[model samples]
Target chain A: MHCLNVELGERSYPIIIGSQLLGDAQHLLPYIRGKQVCVVTNETVAPLYLSRVLEALSEFDKVDTIELPDGEAFKTLDTVNRIFDLLLERRHNRSTTLIALGGGVVGDMTGFAAACYQRGVDFVQIPTTLLAQVDSSVGGKTGVNHPLGKNMIGAFYQPRVVIADMDTLATLPEREFSAGIAEVIKYGLICDEPFFCWLEDNISRLMARDPQALAYAVDRSCRDKAAVVAEDERESGRRAILNFGHTFGHAIEAVQGYGNWLHGEAVAAGMVMAAELSHLRGSIEAGLVERVRALLEAARLPTAAPQGMTTEAFLDAMAVDKKVMDGRLRLVLLRALGDAQIIDDTPRELIEQALQTCGAT
Target chain B: MHCLNVELGERSYPIIIGSQLLGDAQHLLPYIRGKQVCVVTNETVAPLYLSRVLEALSEFDKVDTIELPDGEAFKTLDTVNRIFDLLLERRHNRSTTLIALGGGVVGDMTGFAAACYQRGVDFVQIPTTLLAQVDSSVGGKTGVNHPLGKNMIGAFYQPRVVIADMDTLATLPEREFSAGIAEVIKYGLICDEPFFCWLEDNISRLMARDPQALAYAVDRSCRDKAAVVAEDERESGRRAILNFGHTFGHAIEAVQGYGNWLHGEAVAAGMVMAAELSHLRGSIEAGLVERVRALLEAARLPTAAPQGMTTEAFLDAMAVDKKVMDGRLRLVLLRALGDAQIIDDTPRELIEQALQTCGAT
Candidate 1:
């Protein structure tokens, strides 16, 4: 296993990546300080891997579990309220660490619950899916979806520890895998051309869940994410690159009622749109956009926008996006496939063209 | 005017205490970065002081307001949700500083909103009530009440500045003024014997709204709280002393429903209970307890327990209090009027007796 530590003083925590780490979590229990603990997960993941986690935490009988409905739609303020209620009902204190046991949605909601439960409790992430292990579960970006936006209400709290159990990905559905690779691919396109090339070479092995390729992918991705987050935990500046496709992706998800597209699937489509915008704005070559599109198609992720959405509605939704600085929509466009920068000055014509290419009105 | 700083790097801000600080907020706006400002208050405080605050910020056209229902019961997760909703609806960004314009409840809820809005935004406190100015609005104790407990959901997020308008307290109802004095007295009881002596001599003057006495009280209390919070922002150690009466006070608030007694009123009565326990444990002299009780009575604050509350209910409710350490009650007891210590090893019979003295049975 490879380790990357997010240096946040006493609150700092580690992200570990390896094939058999799930079996080694017993060694990681020192981080969870208290008599009681609660592992929060979702229906999809609970059925496949909760027993394994419970078994991992066999030392603590006070261990309990809560199963939320799976998907991005369940990442609502109401869902977060439910988690708070559950923790309160069980009387979980600040030391009672909440273990998140699913993908990004589960990690976000549980981390948020931990952030607010009894003012704030410790939490650990046990990301079961590829998208989560490499990304969401590592950084402490915990929150529920807002009525008007995604990830709007949250805290920049760090987790106790992040335990990515690679074996759990064997049960993730094919479509989920494709969606997961979008984020895996994002790391390459943003800052690491070598990792991008490595991913290109090993995409099939990663898709097949080959232990070595999967471990390497998770480790390298988490290292990159941890380094970026260590420098800018609250998204003051450098953190914006992680949202390279999120500005457009969030609008897509918002317009489509959020859960209609997998977060990664929408992001895949969003990245294509963002890259095309970068091309039109002269930051990235048109061929780079084609390469991004080709990679998404190869991974079987969506590259086009959702059907029947209007540019005006998309723009309206994007304007309310948390990424919009001072009311102007700021897009994180690729300067090239291996580089990205935020663009607040995108012309109306280019945006309209990108929307037209994506089949939006 | 008296000034205190939170000392939390960029999150650090000042607390200004004086008789007429409401109208003085305009001078503090140079620290405010953007044109948009959102003032969040309740109906009662709005009519009393919002106009004065608005008059100070007349230079900003984008001033918006979110008026929540007034009272401690309204300090719920639902009310916090409403604030986030309003911020999103209004498209308030990080540059938008939330001005909390009421007592502890509004300051806490607003500060909590600032902590979670867009992962964190700047907020200023224009605490209108004595309880807010001298207590909750100073330290970064911002959070909403959970049905399970008071402040069971919150963060230790500091404000950009705390503007305590003592003149606003002139219109405060007598009961609320007495309630607010509980926390003012707490600062003396927990950390400063000299201040305790000072307050003992001037309690009558403060009760009469003597401006100089009020100014000294507010300033000293903010100084005490700022020093503790600077040393321990998250209640890790020194900060826990600030919750001298809060464990019992929280039990009272939760059992009676949040607004049944003003938070400080419950805390006032609770301070007496803690003093009684301290006497029983030989940590403090009974004479000091009498003085604490005498001062509370002189302030016209409740010094004894309420009628008809049973010991079992209080005990059960307190088990859920945020101060429960390792499944046992961790009580903050006074060594004297000003020197306090957290005792986790107190005997059950002693606590039961203190409960009996407070009419909890």
Candidate 2:
């Protein structure tokens, strides 16, 4: 088992990574502070893993479950309200713990519900997807999407614990598995150069579902993210670096419409565009962009924008992105591999050219 | 102008209490960090004071106003979403400051919108009602009511500054004005004995809208509430004392339907019930409960539950309150005139008796 603690004072919690952790009560029991528990999952994940979590929580005084519809399209305030409705109808109080038992969509929505339910309650993250385990589940950033933006409405709410069972990846579809690797690659590009080299060396082992390699990648990714998030929980300054490819990725998701493209897939392509812009800005050599593309290709992730997505569409979507400040778009461009910087003064033409370079019309 | 700071480390902000603070740009602009400003007021308050606020914000590069529908009925996630739509549609970015320019409903929905819009932005509370000025604006409790319960879905988001202009209260309806005094009296009941005495002596002057008496009451209520809030920001411990009458009050508001009885009116009646409960528990003598009723009567506030509301309704409503933990009802009762305690093991029969005693059927 691998464990990493996100060092947020008072909000600090552990990320437990191992196989079959869900069926075990030890990892899950200590973190649940309340007598009542609500397990929030999705249709797809519920069929596979919900019972194991429910079985683990059977000892609690009261246990409930709500299987939200699976997919990014279901991640909206309306969907989250369903959790609130259920919680209220069932009489879940401020002390009840909400366990998110699916992928990023489930984790994000459940965490958000916890943040808002009765003005806040405790929640645990049992992230069943690599995309969630490595990124969303650890950051304390939970929210739903608006038609105008992705993650446009949410809170920076931490969880009591994040249980990432590597065994769940066995059930993840090949495409979704590949998509998760995109964020694993992101940890390398943003702040971990040695991990980038390790990823370059171990991409096939990770793709082949090697448990040891997968666990190592998840731990390293969480450690890197925790360090950044702990420094700036609310994204006041340095924390913006975590959104390296997110601004562009959110644009792709918004223009393509949510659920059309997996978040990690859009981010894979967005990371390529960001790397290209970095090369143009003379912050990194073209070789690094190629390496990012080569690594993503090995994992079967998208290396460019979706078919027919244009620069104009990207511009319109990015205009409403949360990263924009005072009418200026703040783009997180790579100063170098393993280092990213948020720059607001990028020329509009440069951004458009980068989009064109990445196959946007 | 009297300024008091709510001492919450980085989130601490000033509450400016005085007459005509809204028309002055200096009171507002310094707290706003960005050039773009959005004033969130209601249809009722917009005609009265929105123009003055807009004029105060005229020096900003971009200024926008959203006039939400008036009353507690409009305090919903749907109404708050309107603020989000306008913010995105008008391109209000991360640095834009949202000024809530009305009563508690406006302040709550706007503050909640600011809390969730783009995962939080700067907001200022320009409370037009005495309820908001003395209580809601200073506490950082921002949320909208749910159909099942009041304040079921919300966040504990603080503001940059709270501008409580005494001038706006001139046009307030008499019933609503008395409703605000319910909270003003609450500050005395739960924490300030001397302030309670002062209210006893000066209740008529306050009811007559004497500017000095109103300012003194608002300032003292804010200070009392601020002290409790600062000690326990998220209502973990001592802060629950600040909710001395709220659980019962929320039940009244929920059972009677939200716009029928003003929040303060419901709370006024609920305070008497809590006092009755305190007397039943042998914490205080019956004289205090009678004195509570006398003071509320002097202020023209209800000192009992609505005529048709039953003990069954109170039990059903109170059962789902946020204060309930592990299926046990937690009630905040007065220990004496100016002290309160949270007790979760009160017998159900006693609670029903108190409700019946307070005019519930």
Candidate 3:
């Protein structure tokens, strides 16, 4: 087992990574400070892993579970309110700890539920998907989507601990598994050059579900992410670098409709567009863009925008993105592989051209 | 204008108290970090002061207004969602500052909206009611009520500045004005004995709308509340003392229906019950309870629980309050005329007796 601590003072917590760690009371017990526990999972994940967590928490004075419908479309304030309803009905207090037990959607909604439940409560993340374990679970960016944009309503609430069991990946669909790799690739492109080279060397072993390789990727991704988040928990300045492909990716998700494309799939295509724009800005060589595409292709992730997605649609969606400041779109473009910078002065024509290059009509 | 700062590190902000401060661009603009502004006021307040604020903000690049329906019944996640919808529809970006231009309901909903809108943006409080001016607007306890409890869904988000205009109080209905005085009296009873004495002497002057007396009361209440809040920003320890009377008050509000009795009116009655509980616990003399009742009576606030309210209803409602931890009901009771403490071990029988003493059947 490997444990990495996100260095947010007082709010700091550990991310525990290993195989079959779900049923272990030791990893889950110390972090739950309250006598009551509520496990929030989804229909798909509940059938697989809910009972293990419930059994683990059986010693608590009170234990409850709510299995929500599974999918990105269910990630809304209304869905989160159901958690609140169940909590209030069952009389969960301020000291109660909420355990999120599914993929990113479940983690996002449950973490948000914890954030707003009784004006904040302790929560633990048992991320069941690679997309969640590597990216969403670690950063403390918990929220729900609005009809107009993704993650438009939420909070930067940290969990008491994150338990990432590699065994859960065995149940993840092939497409979702590849989606997680998109974020894993992102850590390399944004800040860690050696990890990028390592990914290039180890992509096959990771795709083949090699436990050792998968654990290393998750650990390295969390370590890299923890370092950036430690410096800026609220995404004030340097933290904006973490949104490298998210601006374009959120646009894709918004235009394509959430759940139509997996978040990681949109990000895979968005990263390609970002890399192509980096080449257009003469910040990086065209070879790096091709390298990003090749790596994503090897992972079975989408390398371009969805079919029939137009540049106009991208522009409209991106306009309402949280990254836009003072009417200027802040795009995180790669200055070079392993280094990204947020630039607000990018010409619209350049952005449209990059979208065109990435197969946006 | 009298300005008091709530000294929360990095989250600290100034509360400006005076007559006619709302329409002053100088007071509003310095705290606003961006060019775009959205004023969230209810229908009642918009017709009174929203236009003055809008006119003052006319110089900004973009200005928008959203007038929600008035009253506590409308303070819900559904109502807050309307603000989110308008923000997205108007393309209000991360840099837009939300100005809450009404009483506590509008301030809380707007502050909470600002807290969750794109995971937080800047907001300023234009508190038009004395309840907001002295208590809610200054403390940074922003949230909407849940069906089960008051203030069950919210955040501890501070505004860039709080603008408390005393001039608006002249137009306030007499009942609502007395309700605000309930909190003003609370500051004196909980932590400021000298101020409590001053209120006893000036109660009639304050009720008569003497500008001097009102300003002094607002300033004193803010200072008292600010000192306590600074020591415990998240209500972890000593801050719970600031919730003196809220446990019983929330019960009354929940059982009687939210908008039936004003928040301060409910609190006024609850304070008497807490005072009686304090007396019953042998913490204070019976004279203090009578004094509290007399002051509330002078303020034209309720001195006991509403007629026909039953002790069982109070117990059922109070059991679900956010103050409850691990099934133990934590009650804040007066230790003396100017001091308070949180006691969670209060016997259920004594609580029922206190409720009965306060006219609960």
Candidate 4:
């Protein structure tokens, strides 16, 4: 078991990563602020792990559950409203803690639910997939996708505690596993060159589901993410670097529709475009961009935007991204491998050229 | 103009109280985060003050407006969703600022919209009605009402600045004027015995809309509410005391259905019931309870609960209140004319008797 703390002063919380921790009351108990709690999960995960969580929290005075449909398409205000309805119907109050018991979509919606529920409530993240365990579950960015943009509506609400149970990842689909690897690669591409090399050497071991390798990668990703979050919880400054590929990735998700491409896959392609832009700006060597593409390909992730996507569409979608400031597009571009910077002064033609190279007609 | 600061570190903002400040561009310019700004108002207020606010912000790069139906009945998630849709459709990014130009309903919904739009955005409060000027616009309590409870969905998002124009209050209806006085009197009943006495002596002057009396009341009310909010931003401790009559009042609004009785009217009756409970609990003298009722009646506010409201319905509604902790109802009850405390252990029969005395059938 590995426990890492996201040092945020009074708002700080611990992330516990281990096998078979889902049914362990010791870890989940301390975070429960009151006797009343509700576990929010998706239909896909509820039948698999809901009872385990319910049994773990059986000693609580009152326990309820809300099961939402599985998929990014279901992440909406309407879904969040349903969670609010369940909590209100059960007479849950500010003291009642909410446990998010699934992947990123479930965690995002539940954390958002907790953030807006009676102003805010304590919520525990029990992420059940590789994609969530290594990324979204670590940062406090909880929100839903809008018809116009992905994650266009949300909050920066931290969780009381995050329990990343490795056992649950054993059931993740093959494509989902690869998607999680994209984010794992991102932490390296953004800040840790050595970790990137480590991934390069051990990609197959990770693909084979080597427990030690997966644990190390998840821990490293969280530590990298935690450090960034601690400095800028609200993404007002340095935190923007963590979104190295999200700008283009979100556009793909928004243009192609949210559920069409998994978030990590979209991010994988986004990182390639960012790498291309970095090369065009003379910020990185062309060989590094090739290595970035090779890595995503090795991980079975998309290395380009969907073929039909146009540079104009990408530009339009990117304009509405959360990163835009005062009508200027602020992007996280690599200054060098293992180093990222938020740059808004890059020429528009350079970005357009990068998009063209990445199959954005 | 009298300027009072709500001392919330970094998020601290000034409450500017005076007459005829609506079209003052100088006051509104500094708070605009970006060139893009959206003004959210209501039908009733839009026809009255929208043009003035728009004229004030005409220099912004892009300006848009959303006019919701006037009244507390429209303070729902649906209305907030409409605001979100407009912002998204217009490509309003995080840099865009939102200006709420109306009474409490518009301000509360607009503030909530700002809090949830792209996670959060900047918003300024241009409160037109006395009720909003004194209460909702100051504390950053932004949210929409739910079927189960009032303010069941929202956030504690502070605004950039609050522009409370006394001129708008001149156009306020007599019923709305009376409703505003209920909150003004709350400041006195909760923590200011002297203010309570002053209100008693000057009730008729305020009722007649004397500018000096109105300004003093608005400034004092904001100061009192601001101090409490600064001490406890999320209503954890001292802030709950600020909700002196709100537990019962919110139940009144929820049971009678929100727009049926103005928030201040329900709060007026709720204050009367709280006084009755305080008397039965031996915390205050019967004479004090009579004074509370007498003062509300002087303001043309209802001093009794609605005709058909039952103690059971209030209990049912109050159970879902944000103030409830772990299924226990924690209510802010008056200890004396100038003192209030959040007490959860008060006898249920005493509360039921208090409800009965307040016209609960």
Leading candidate by DockQ: 3
Chain B alone vs. reference chain B, TM-score for every model? 0.96, 0.99, 0.99, 0.98
Q: For candidate 1, write residues B1-361 as lDDT tens digits.
A: 7777768776788777766667765556876777778999999988887888888888885899989898887888889999988888988876688888888888899999999988888888888888888887666888887667777788878877777767888899999989888998998999998998998999889999998889888888888888888887778777889998888887787788777788889999899999999999988888888999999999888876778888787789888788887687888998766788888888888988998987787
Question: Please, what are the lDDT tens digits per residue for candidate 3 over residues B135-242?
Answer: 886778899988878888999899999888889999999999999999999999999999999999999999999999999999999999989988889888898887
DockQ of each: 0.72, 0.84, 0.88, 0.82
* Candidate 1 lDDT, A1-361, residue by residue in tens: 6777878677788887766666565646878788788989998878788877787788874888899998887888788888788888888776788988899888888888888886788888888888988888656788888868888899877788888877888888998888889998998999898998887777788878888888888888888787777788778898889998887888899888877888899999888888888888888777778878887888889998888888887788887887776767778888776788877888887898997887787
Q: What is the Cα-based TM-score of model 3?
A: 0.99
Weakest lDDT window of 10 consecutive positions for candidate 2 chain A:
A319-328
- lDDT per residue for candidate 2 within A1-361, as digits (tens), equals 9988889998889999999898899999999888999999999999899888888888998899999988999999999999999998898888899999999999999999999998899999999999999998677999998877788889989999999999999989998999899999998999999999999999999999999999999999999999998898988999988888888898988888898889999899999999999898888999989999999999999989888888999998888888887788899999888999999999999999999999998
For residue B118, give model 2's deviation from the true position in Å: 0.9
DockQ of 1: 0.72
Looking at model 3 chain A, which ten-residue stretch has the lowest summed lDDT?
A49-58
| Model 4 misplacement above 4 A | none
User: How do the predictions measure up, each by TM-score?
Assistant: 0.97, 0.98, 0.99, 0.99
Candidates ranked by DockQ: 3, 2, 4, 1
Task: Name the runs in model 3 displaced over 4 angstroms.
Answer: none
The pairs that clash in candidate 1 are none
* lDDT comparing candidate 2 with the true structure: 0.91
* lDDT of candidate 2 over B1-361, digit per residue (tens): 8899999999999989998778899998889898898999988998898888888887989899899899999999899988998988898888999989889999999989998987889999989988888888777889998898889999999999998889989999999999999999998999999999999999999999999999999999999999988888988898888888888899989988899999999899999999999999999999999999999999999998898899999999998988887888889999899888899989999999999999999
